[model samples]
Target: MELSPSAHVDTFCRDRLPPFDLWPQLHFDLPELRYPERLNCAAALLDDAVARWGADRPCLLTPTDSWTYGDLLRRANQVARVLTEDFAVRPGNRVLLRGPNNPWLVAAWFGVMKAGCVAVTTMPLLRAVELAQLCEISLPAVAVCDHRYLEELQVADAPDMRIVAYGGGAPDDLAARCAAKEATFQNVDTAADDVALIGFTSGTTGRPKATLHFHRDVLANADTFSRHVLKPRPDDVFTGTPPLAFTFGLGGLVVFPLHAGAASLLLEQATPDQLADHVADHGVTVLFTAPTAYRAIMAAGKADRLAKLRRCASAGEALPAQVWEDFRTATGLRIIDGIGATEMLHVFISAADDDIRPGSTGRPVPGYRARVVDEAGEPVPDGEPGLLAVTGPTGCRYLDDPRQETYVKEGWNITGDTYVRDADGYFWYVARSDDMIVSSGYNIAGPEVEKALVVHPHVEDCAVVGVPDERRGMIVKAYVVLKPGLTGGVTTVKELQDHVKRTIAPYKYPRAIEFVADLPRTSNGKLQRAELRSRAVGAAG
Candidate 1:
């Protein structure tokens, strides 16, 4: 699909450009580089916004409460003092924050930064086993959890971790201690290179790896992507469905809005219908969510309620062409789809309004360079598919993991995604390199099959994966969720399989189908193909 030109988005693209020197050994000094010896995200981003925008402006909004810029700053400082004087949280200390998306989570996140501690945010839905694994790896000193999810943090084996509960009856003892303390707190003296947060990747293919980001790296994303790609206005309100624990959601819903002096509409429950209601009620201008949510909103015929939105961004997975087309037809808005990872901090490649190419993930954003490389790290031809290698202001810094060598080679961060760059520099996403199914000497991407099924009227959600087969070595298997009125049966499965054959290459059609009520998704709304593959293997066994 082609995108028409827009003055606002087009101006942003024109002002940002790639580095002049493109050789393998050449490096160019960038004028936008502003790195201080000491850095604190709370001071550099949030405090600066409050000072420039004034105290009256709303900084964060939840269903039940709203905090002004000054209010948020004061509360963050209060939490910072409590963490430092009472809990002994200091530099290099890791603190775990597990809760639903709310104003308290934002306050605690900034407070952790102000106290010069590393904030390791985990999903609220994580079970004891997952929580234990994260605790073992991160070795957090303190845990601040919402009262609703306190049971999940009650692991029998978590060693010497302090638990602070919020949203319950704020214990008088704890409240008294906090109330007595002064709200004025100084920013911790931290270097720009000091690690601020440890974001764990959603391990759909392997064990989850922790990706560390420095203080400057955090703000760099706001400068590059938020300034160049999102361009959120100060009066705009932002809302999204991604959990704040995920870096994609953290940047889009929290950091970007704070950096831009805009307010974020936070929701404890982020269903599609609820999100639409919030957008209409709050006059939210910018919306960040996944492709599935967009499809659901269109399916529900509620796109008209989003008339207040000025920009819509999709991430966490590839955006299907059909979803994009449907949204444009319904709302006359082009959904900006970008590919990002926890390792990259934020989106490195994206399309602005003028340069959008449907079925493509757009060109590299400013301050970042992307290349498709062969197995030996050599650049491939423009049209040939290869592993996507990216280098920019923010890159992966894993936590004591040997896999760092595999992901970050030399200076470039090697994303496991396979992509093809066209002659015009538009990057087309293929699939995860490891997820490419090789069957009878043919390469098949699971997303291709899933996209085909989504275009069909009966399919709601689906996950495609490769299952072990003696005859073909690996066979395509699709785990599908049908629409609300559609019934899953043998005849429907055969018809869907035939639909896939007609949509794409015949060999890529699903050999087997399992209709289910829902697909297993991560807290960030990414499809967990690994879980589906495991289920298939277990069934075969």
Candidate 2:
């Protein structure tokens, strides 16, 4: 399909998408999955809300202000006008959006889509060198940034890129320029399969991988997971900690709530205590955050404040059984744990309420299919650990990268996760396939050891990785963050070792344990095992 109509523009993302055959099998059998051939997701998500629901409906809320659907729609329209008329952005142009999770960021996201420009949203915490790597990959023509972040983007060394900053009162700022624009705009008519966003995965080594998603891919996620699994209502208030740059946040905090005609609170910073306080004060019904955040809320003694929440979604990392049980014991709400990847737009495997199995990542969402497979891409029998493979409407489409072959093989997206499916079809997460540690002829999932250790009273957070050992080839090493006022001495180390031995197989216990104030994590809150491995190597050397 011809997605872009403008003649004078760059088609970088579209040109770089992996061949069709390399894409995982896409299914859209559900009635709600039907989408028009030509679509602008922004119009469907924003403009349609004003038409279907009333303009007076609450859409976005911040600590200081709340915006109705009409307000967001008009602002997004003004942004589109500013981009096309003032910045010379045309259809098929690439625009980079930089900011934390806030109303302006959401407006800029819709503005890019309305103008038919592919949006590239980056984490606010990324340094210049990392930003330089992204610029080298997507080559965005224009960047809409929060004014405070302009210096870093400038230092990224993209000579040709034009930047427009907002969040400051400068006359040249995007908000200032947008003030003069009309509150109405004719959105570009983009095809369903048009590249809408390039989500960059925060990999530990080498350049980050840019995952391409079509305009349809965006709606598909909301329609599938949000519609079926979350089942959000119009009165539901959504909030989360994941940055919009992460597809997890995009789907959970933005797309899902909007699709349901619900209100969302955008926090520039949502620490665990703050998140819990917001839930109580705002009457938030649903929350989307990481497992760590959930654990923190319980640890900070703010779990009771979250009594107002009915549904709590966890992702970005595995939800340990201990954490899940502790949360349920405190809040009486079973946290919905799902496994999603940047390649697949959002959560495909998830279960809510009574369907939730504490430790297992639930069955696939209605529109998707999943399986555990061997190295040869063949199915592994139930109860056997294998690669997690999924096929659905949304799949991996790497931008100009040959790793496409490694991610999507024979119509299944290899998620790089080791999983074991029980007789009942619940998928139990083992670890990142690469994270499985082989020590002394024994296979141990690092996360399993971490899970056992995290249940200890003194442990706040921890990571387990295999370190090279002359006698055993490799030995399990754990880096732990202890609770406040708890010291990690020799006595504590032996106590944790004994605890792990008692919890699971004795051989799987950590042979070495180090104490740290915090564990390294990606901006999206996933543990950076690769960095932990490097730290272990450094300590051993």
Candidate 3:
């Protein structure tokens, strides 16, 4: 239970950290991974970057405006002031950010860190109930949300949480408040081990768990994965489709570029065509997104538009070898594929340049170690499918959740993904070992969709499984047992899909629905998920 004397006054996150013995073994073997005892990532990424790269270097970009390192620094400093002076937000308080990716949202994230508060950034697509669950978990003192997306947060009504909107023309808006503040506020001198942010990930059971990351953990991902693998240049322009709430987008679009003194084009919304247009028009050198998007752009004949990209990264879900080969054949640039989890922060395993293996999730990045293990946690031989265990500078640290034991076992972060390690040390992707369905880079739980479906009056029973899709990698497909009187047809399928969307995030809704008399079940009454998944794959094949 030895932790640094924490800088957080609230102590909520610090108090909730899993005991040290339960934590996975953390490594800082790389020169870059070694950090000082007292470090604030906001200052290290923003202020220090501004100092090293000069103030006028462009840092954040959108279709509408560009923010220089100086511009972002001044605005971030102002945001820190507004939080303290205007909203009475104290150091160590959690500041929930709800918005699409934009310059203002970026500013708010840095500002919260600089103020020594934990930043809990949520996906803008989340509904009121979803937002309320996050609010209950983190207990943020203030929520700096996008003005256009204020209704859900308001409906959430988190107790004692003040809501402030950004990007509004109102006199009391966040923009106006920032305009009144000075741009030279001091950053809080927090310990390297101080809790910086809490990213939420849905477990196999569909329950969202909060993963706590320290200030040092924030930079460790960039230092190891981004530095050694992506090798971003100072002039690179970053753009991606994953929301900042997803650790993937945060690293690709914000943290990695900032660490390299490059510019990130923050798009509030991007379709495959729109992303291609932006990459071409904005002179984007580096692109981060899912394999589904890459295939969509190619299918839509927009692949040629991405000729400007020098480096492309694919994650969020497994990148199919065919997608990798096709994109390369289209653009003459190989896509770097990797696997990262919210609990671990960013990419720990990836390959770049000549080391690229078409479909394999390349060897672990510098400062990390990975292996395949059996159900008993013993290492499995190469070429055998088993649970992927990894140890790195950052590992799973769930906040006050018993599932910490489930994720971290025998001192290794056991990523629920099943993988086969070749004799060459390359990890080949197998199906997910857990009940989580990753579709188009989104991790959705089958049980969550099942939960939403059973509540509908029309559905007597339902089982959701991840079925293969060429574009999305995997799509949620639900097999249903409808009430005796109702005929499940196109109309009923539409009804169930709409019902699930209303109940949870729209992405988790089942894309395909088939009416069945009953679902396969064990004699003991357990759902036979593996059987359904196998049948779905066979049928798809």
Candidate 4:
């Protein structure tokens, strides 16, 4: 599918053209893009789906019930009316949504968009402190939460935010209120460039950064990944484990499926076992999940249930060659691994069926350009490891964050990932640029060590980080999670360290090892190396 010259400009305008025509020229330019523009994602995508696919087609499928395209539209409209008439939610208001992945959460997201309020979806695992911090940063006017997790949002320090509880049989009260409310609400006149959502990064290191996306960005993933990568059929059913708050989940579980007029199975609790069951029960054709979950499901011997899935996508971390091979051997389907960030909106690099290589993240998708660059921002030769830089339809646009200068350099969003492009143009994953460990002046990628450790029979999960040392400057430290029933002590640690020494470079072996029941992970399931690094520094001190 070759995009015409005007196609680029037309798609840009259509995707981003806000209701009020704010910052019209900014939409066309690159670096000069700014916020406070008019935008509403519900109008652009969900409403379009209702128009084309009609309301009778299944749009949201869960363990409890299924919602057709029309049902979702009506519920979202009812939600919009409830927010506007009852809760007093208005344009430019920031509304925080706290809940597990379910049909209500999806409805609330579109309703928030329909009401012209920015949606701030958070991970359900966050406690009061994390929730309070996000509320402080966003200063949200209202919060819609699942009654099951309401206690987590009841932090005393949170600024007087209004709360509306969903589920838990509030049906008699809230349902009556929803029925009395108007089912049709007009879209607020918003510019296509206005901030539609404030997606907070999983703060593995320091404070989480809120990456801003406009209405156009919500659909950009569909045009890029849905069109090029998965190519879902209208009859395909989609499901995943990533939280809807994370762009990874939102793209695969919500946007891609909705855009293609397919059904999505949204689970409040998506364990590997639950995922396998859903695929079998709902005939889910497309699966989106992390590499860790894939490994876990393979270990659990549930690969047979996933055979019905036609397309599978892996992200949130590197996909190990062994995991890829094991999944394919069991399910007879190649898992397409891609690398995406909140900044880029969705996966910028991925492989379709025929283009996949076991260990390599395929070349950049259409409408995007990716290259490896050196310290000075010069392109590195093919087969040389360097920082990955990307420029395309959807790039990093932070919300008045100082880190913008660091991430968006020279019109390209320089993802923190380090990679090497082979002569064949396949991009191989290295460690995060900040995660590169320097031991005795040798730069070793932590992912390489972690991948080696995962292949061990006794190791279930592991994270490799650098600890400060006086002599070596920084020494490799490994925090490992043993498989169930495996003992963790000096003997096992030594054996795992020896295993790493044999797998890759001898010097990359962990000088220090700690065994735990579980390793820290971000909301999206990425390893929290920054947290591990902090612990390592504290231990060294």
- In Å, residue 509's CA in model 4 sits off its true spot by 1.4
| Model 3 per-residue lDDT tens digits across residues 148-242 | 99998899958789999988898998999999999998898899999999998743234579999999999999999999999999989999888
| Worst ten in a row by lDDT for model 3 | 519-528
Looking at model 2, the pairs that clash are: none
Instruction: Indicate whether candidate 1 or candidate 3 has the larger TM-score.
Output: 1
TM-score of each: 0.93, 0.98, 0.83, 0.91
> Best candidate per TM-score, number?
2
lDDT digits (tens) for residues 1-541 of candidate 1: 1112211211211122122121112122245547766778889777888789998899899877889988888878888888888888767688899998998888889998888788899999899888888888788888988888989798725878888887777663233445677878888777776678889889644567877777877888888888888898888899999899999889998999988889999887777877888899888999999998999888787899999999999998999888888899999999999999898889989996878988899998887899999988999999999999998887766676667768766567889999999999999999988779888889999999999998888988988999999988899999989989889889998899999999999999999999999998876678888788889999988
Question: By lDDT, is 3 or 4 better?
Answer: 3
Clashes of each: 0, 0, 0, 8
Q: RMSDs, each prediction?
A: 7.8, 1.5, 10.0, 5.5
User: Which portions of model 2 show Cα errors greater than 4 Å?
Assistant: 1-9
User: Which candidate number maximizes lDDT?
Assistant: 2
lDDT comparing candidate 3 with the true structure = 0.88
lDDT of 4 by residue, 1-541 (tens): 1111221111322233222212111122333222224446687668878888787999998887988988888888888888888888667677888888988888889998887778899988788988887887777788888888889798635767888888876763344556777777787656565567888887534566777676767866787777778899999899988899999999999998887889999887767877797788888899998898888888888888887899999999999999999888988999999999888878989997889999998998765678999877899999889999987767675554567777766666789999999998899999899989998999999999998998999988899999988999999999988989988888988899899999998999999999888888765678888888888898888
* Regions of model 3 farther than 4 Å from truth: 202-206, 435-541
What's the lDDT for all of these models?
0.83, 0.90, 0.88, 0.81
lDDT, residue 281, model 4: 82
- In angstroms, how far off is 216's CA in candidate 1? 0.4
Error of 3 at 42 (Å): 0.7
